[model samples]
Each structure stands twice: as C-alpha cells, then as structure tokens.
Target: MKQKPIHPALEPYLEGKVLLVNKPLHWTSFDAVRKIRGFSRITKIGHAGTLDPLASGLLIICTGKFTKKINEYMGMEKEYTGSITLGASTPTYDLESEPENQQDISHITEEMIHAATAQFTGPIMQVPPSHSAIKKDGKPVYLAARKGIDVELEPRPITIYSFEITRIELPVVHFKVVCSTGTYIRSLANDYGKALGVGGYLSSLCRTRIGNFSLEYALSVDAIGAEIQHLKNSYIPPAGGYTDAV
Candidate 1:
C-alpha cells in the first residue's frame, strides 16, 4: 500500500549528513531510505544496517559523501531488547508466522531461565531463519519457504557479548542482549527455546543501540522529514537555528 508524503523539508538532505532514525514496525529499512532519498532528491543515500520489518529501533542513514561510512557503522556491536515466547515455535521465528503447537512451559522455572542464558553469552553458531533475507541459489529463502520448500541453511559464527533475562512471565521471557554485528536476534530466540527444550520463538524485538549510537539520539521518520524541510533553500539565506542534530 502506498503511504502519504513524508515531509516537505526533505530537500535539505542533498548536503552530506548522517542521520539516526528510529525505524517503525513493518517498515523495511529500504523504505526509510527511499523516503529520505525522494525527499532530499539525493540519489547517493544509503543505510548502515538492515532491520527486519517485524522489528523497530535505531537505524543509521548516510547521504552524499557520508554514505561511504556505512560499512564502518555496520561493523559496530549492536544492543537489542525484546521478548521471547516459550512453549511454542513459529516458522518465521516471530509474529510474522503462526505459532505451532505449544509445549508445556509450566514446568520451566525462573532459575532455569536465568541459568540458560549463560550458555549463549559467548561465541555461538547461529543458523539464519528460513524466512529471512538470506539467499539460497540466488533467490531469497523466504520465497521458497513460502512455497513449502524446506531450506537447510548452514550455521555460522556469531558472538554474543551478553544475554540477560530482564523479566519472566510464564510463557514470555523479556531479554536484553549485546552482540556483534550480523547477529540475528530471531535466530537467537529460536536457539534459546531449543536449549531449554520447551520450544520458543521471538515475540517482539527492538534494537536499542549500535556501537556508540543510541535510540535516544534518533529522530522519528516524520520528525526527520520536518527537520529537513526546515533547511534553507538556494534562494534563502542561512538561518541561525539550523544546526546538525546528529
């Protein structure tokens, strides 16, 4: 579905700048970039990282010459907070797919949940979810998975600096994790459930930090467009209030 215009102030993005944006749920990382690109009429824009449509949080965007710095930001460690639902599994690993038959999570204890976290605190091997952006034979795995094709993906190395269960409410486990770049939190949720033998999947997710950049410094999509619209045009003189928010 097509959405409304982002903001009229986007033309200011033509000048080189790095922006911290709080991505909204169900909006692809590309969607955010497209809006900014169109608003600024600048074709050299790009994002530093990708976020699943099911997730929301900090996204670093670069424009003009700053786009060259994308790889540097993408290499930074990431921090995320989200909930995992025990007692069930999902094909997509999150709310994107329907849940399978649930297991008996009643027997799970708070101590077990806390103890299980230690197993994932260091380096680990994680298989990207079938319904993820990963490609198999040049096509996205999700396209084949949706057609009932079973794709056996290889597990790769990823480091988890820390994993903490912040809250436990029966079938739901709230957590905060710090990890290296390229770590898939959904896969982590799936693996965590399997470790406990109760079956689990990601229920919710939010990226809180990427290296030194935090969500606290990010502007909403609309707010960013508004800020850009406030920029001085070629016909106008420089205004005193215009300052780099990043």
Candidate 2:
C-alpha cells in the first residue's frame, strides 16, 4: 500500500495533534482515542465526546498539545441518524442490552410515527434513560441498574432542532436528529415510545456530524491503523493541547 504524506503545517500541529476519526459501531469513543494514540505513538491523547458502544460516527481525537482543545469540541452541537424499535424497552437505550418488555406494534403506522415525532421537535423536557451513565448517589446509574436497583432521575430541558422519520417497518422507525449539547438520543427514543402508548428503545445510532465536521471527511480505524507508523516517523511538533481533541 502507498503511504499518504502528512501535510506540512499539519505536520507540526499533528506531532501531537487532533485527528477527526470516524468510529465504527460496537467501539467506544475511548477505544478510538486509544487506537489513534497508538498509531501516532503519542502519549497525550484524548477525545472530545463520548459515543455509546452501540453508536458509530465521527469521533474527534486529540494528540499531544491538541488534547487541550477537547472541551471546545465537546461544546459543539451534534447530528445523529438512528433507528428505534418502537415496541420494546431495553435496559440500555440501544440493542446492547436486553429488552425489559415488548409491546404489540401491529397497530402503529408510518403516519402515526411521523406525527408522534412532531411532539419531540423544539424544546421539551426529556427524562434521561434509566440505564444511562448519569450519576446517582455518586455512582453511575447503569451500575445501580446492573445491581437490580431502581434509581430516580430528573428530566431536563433539551432542544430537538428537528426529527425526521425516514422509514418505518412495523415497530422499527429510522430517523435523523439534530440536537443541542447534553441531549441524550437514547432518552429521546424511550420518550418517543411513551408518546405512542408503547415503550421504545434505540436499536441503532450513528453520529453523522459535530459542529462543522462531518463523518464524510472522517478517517476509518482501518485506514488509520494502516498509516500508523508513517504518522509517528515524520512531523514537526505543535504547541499547546486542546480540550476537545477526542
């Protein structure tokens, strides 16, 4: 395979720089950061945001001084495309965990699904999913849930810029969403199900973009791995790390 040369200005900044990586499903954001750090042979590596293991998409990774900008990336808005199985509720919002219960979705229609999505658009009070990583009593709620303990969480305001249902088949609904920072799509899925009188959970989720960066310009893990050695071998070092490089 031919090696791609590193850009000149980018070379210095990247000596320990930020890389926008396209993460694959079933891999945590931490996993992506680790891979990039290993590839670049840089110790100061970090990520700007966290994507659930079930989610696939753009993951901003920072190396060396770029790690200082991690917080900047975290402040940006996010766009996601995913699907929720409308008739089921799971321990986690996605398929990573087993469903707590299933409901009959035969009565649901595409029209109903579209209409239900409208209620979620704009500003709304959203309750976080019970199985989320939110802290309760100083412990992650997921930890408590794993122990078969029920924890109470409060609902917070989240803006759903837009929600479009692209396709529907029985209990499954495919859609896209643009939301503000701190918004939980998993909770959105669960809430969407409740609105329809049936519980629901996310079966699939992918972060399509964050701020001005889109997955279209992201590098895959395989591609990064293939070029790992080259990245470390050449490059001028840049100064100052970023907070949101992950």
Candidate 3:
C-alpha cells in the first residue's frame, strides 16, 4: 500500500535524527519505517530490529546519519509480554494461522505451567518457526512452508534470560520473557506447549523492551509525524527526545 505524504513541519528533522516509534500490532516493522520515512520526508530511514507482524512494541528508527547506529541497537536483548493458548497448534505458531486442532487441557495444573517455564530459561535449542521470515535456500521460510515444501531446519542455541508465567487459566497462559536478540516468542510458545504434553500457539504478543529502550519511550507514528511537520525546512535536530523516551 502507498503511504500518505509527510506533513510539512517534519521534513527538517528527517535530515539526520533517530526516531523512537511504538510499532502497532499486525504491521510489519518495515511498515513502521516506511510510515516514518513518509512523515519525516527522508529517504534514508531504517529500523534497528524487525518485529513480527503479530508483535507490537518499540521500533528504533534512524534517519540519515543516525542510520549508522542500527547494528548497535539490533544486538540488544529484548523483553516481551504475551499470551499463549494451550492445547492447540497453528501452522504459523501464532494466531495468524489456522489452528489444526485443540487438545483437551483440563488436566494441566498451575504448578505444571510454572515448571514448564523453567525448562526454557537459560540456554536452549530452538527451531525457527516454519512460517517465519527466516531465509532458507534464498527464500523466506514462510514462502516455502506455504508452498507445501518441507524444509529441514536445525535447532539453534538461544538464551532465555527469564520466562515467567504471569497468569494461567487451564488452556491459556500469560507470560513475560526476557531473552537474547534472536529468540522467537512464538516458537517458545509452541515448545512450551509441547513440553507440557499439549499444544500451544501465541495468542497475543507485545514487546516491552529492546536493549536500553522500552515501549514507554516510544512515540506513536502519528505523533512523530506531527512533530516532524512542526519542524519543516529547518536543519534536523539531534535525537535528544528520541533517546530520552526510549
């Protein structure tokens, strides 16, 4: 979809400022960057990290010269709060896909849920979700998976610093997790369910933190655009407000 044009004021800030944006759910990280670029009226905008379409949270965007710092931010740890529906499996490992079936989860206990979380903490091997953006044979895994092509993907190591079950109601579990950069929460949800002898898939996901930045510091894309419009043809300013908010 074509993005609307930027407001007049923000054109000036597009020159070389970093933007902290709160990415909305169901929007790709690229979508957020594109929107920001449109608002800032700069062609040199980029995001530090990628967030799944089902995830929402802080998305650090750099414009012009600030784009140099993208790699630095991408390496930071991330935190998330999400819900997993137990007793079900989805092709996408999330609510975005059709669930194959729902298992009977009446026997699951709160204690088991708590214990299951521990297994995922610390270093663990995780297989990337088949319906993910991960490249396999030069094509996104999701594309191959959708084409009914079975691809062999090995499990790789990823550290999960923390995984806590905040709430549990039979087949639904709410959790908060802090982990390394490459960790995939959807895969975690799938693995967690399997560990418990049931199935599970991510129902909702919200990124709370990424490295030193948090969602608390992010500006809505509209708000950032408004600020951009207020600055206009003036020289773009430093990312003072951007850093402070994140």
Candidate 4:
C-alpha cells in the first residue's frame, strides 16, 4: 500500500511542540484539541488546562513529547478578564445555565464593589461549582448535577494575586484577575456578589494568559489548520516513496 507524504515541517510537531490556541466561546477545551489533532495528525496531543464551554481564550495545546509538560503548565498562574453579572445566580455559575435567584442591586455602589475585591484577593478558600468537571465517585460532578443531585464540595485554598474591578455598569461588572492554577472565576463571581449582599454569576469569561503565555500570541484552530495545509502543500516526497509515519 502507498504511504502518505510526511512533510518536514510536521516532523517538529511529532517530536514535540506547544501551540497556543484562542479557544472560541461555547467550545470545550477538548474540541480545540480534537480540531488540532485532526489537522496536525499528531495523536499524542493534550491541552494544559480545561476551559468551560461558556468561557474562551488561550488554551495551551502540547503535541508528542511536549504532552508531558501539561502538568507543569497546568500548575502555572493564570490571568482572566470577564464580566460578572450581579443580581442573579446560575446553576453552572456561568451562562451555560439559566440565571436564577434574582436580587435587587439598587443598594450596590462602586465603593462596595471595590471593597469586595479585597475579600477575594490574596489566599482564600473557594468551593468549586457543583456543575463542574470535578470528579466525584469516578464521575464528573456535573453529570450528577444534571440529574438534580447535590454534590457537597469542600473549599480549597487558592491565591488571587490580584482582582481588579475595571468597569462597573449596574448589573454588569468587568474585571481582571490573576490567580493560581486551581482558582475558579465562576466561584469568585458568586462570592463577590454574596459579599455585596447581591447574588452574582459569571456572565462571560476569557482567559488572557497562562503564566507567561498570552492569548495575543495564540491563533485560532482554522489558522493552525491552514498552516498545516500550507506545510503539506509544500511537501517534497523522498526519492523512493512517502514516509510510512503520518
């Protein structure tokens, strides 16, 4: 049987390469990985961290030997920018679920919002959302949540390097946060609204950075696919035949 052409450019990816992808909204982290794997044809690909389908931004995808570095990358600090909608809560803590438990934010003031940040900044214990990917009894807690089962989760310590409230427009509060690996911005929004005596939920989220890697340097899945196509297009088969490996 004839073998497929293996371009020299693809060799680097098979050996190992870290790709920065700007994950699109409503797409799971796995979706982005699958798209890259399909085009790059590198089976040993994995993403450093998981982003909720409601959230978007920088996703670090490692291929081949670089997959081993996923854990290391997962432990690094992350930075995010998003808007938290006060006066309403959600089951998923974000827009993935319907908003509920509405409250009046008439009493909420800019001073109160700024003060709330201090409570979450630095080291604090936070509970992960019940409707989250966190495993419980060998299954994702979200699976149980969907069946109306309540999962009790203990609070875990996470450092919020900084939490800056950049804009405030009544029910919507835009902010930037630099936090530790395990920090969940959804929980932070909930807690912040609670601190202000008004329930809150994450309306929109975008991870701008993970450690030193920024979303600005990342490319979309389509762009990466085009790059792969370009490389394949420029392929020059060896004298005998194409490579046996993809």
> Candidate 3 at residue 56, lDDT?
86
Q: Tell me, by lDDT, which candidate is best.
A: 4
Q: Which window of ten consecutive residues has the lowest lDDT sum in model 2? A: 1-10
Error of 2 at 127 (Å): 1.7
RMSD of 4: 2.7
lDDT of each: 0.86, 0.81, 0.83, 0.91
Residue 141's lDDT in candidate 3: 87
**TM-score-better candidate, 1 vs 4:** 4
Off by over 4 Å in 4: 1-8, 241-246
Kindly list the per-residue Cα lDDT of model 1 for residues 97-180, writing each as its tens digit. 899967998789999999999988899888889987788899899999999989999998989999999999879999999999
Off by over 4 Å in 1: 1-12, 233-246
* Residue 84 C-alpha lDDT in model 2: 89
lDDT of 4 by residue, 46-117 (tens): 999999888999999998789999999999999999999999998888888899998999989899999889
Rank by TM-score, descending?
A: 4, 1, 3, 2
Which 10 successive residues of model 3 have the least lDDT summed? 237-246
- For model 4, name the residue pairs that clash: none
lDDT of candidate 3 over 1-246, digit per residue (tens): 242444434444444676778999889999998887666557777999898888888889887677888998888999999899999899888988888777898888888889988889999999999888889878888898988888778899999999999987767799999999888899999999899888999999998898878899899889987776555544344665222110
TM accuracy, model 4:
0.94
Alpha carbon deviation, residue 131, candidate 1 (Å) = 1.0
* Per-residue lDDT of 232 in model 1: 28
Query: For residues 1-246, what per-residue lDDT tens digits would candidate 2 score against the true structure?
Result: 232444343355455666778898889888887776555545567889899998898999877577788899898989999998888798777787888787888888777899998999999888887787889878788888878887788989888899999888767889999998889999899889989988999898999999998999899977876666454445444665322221
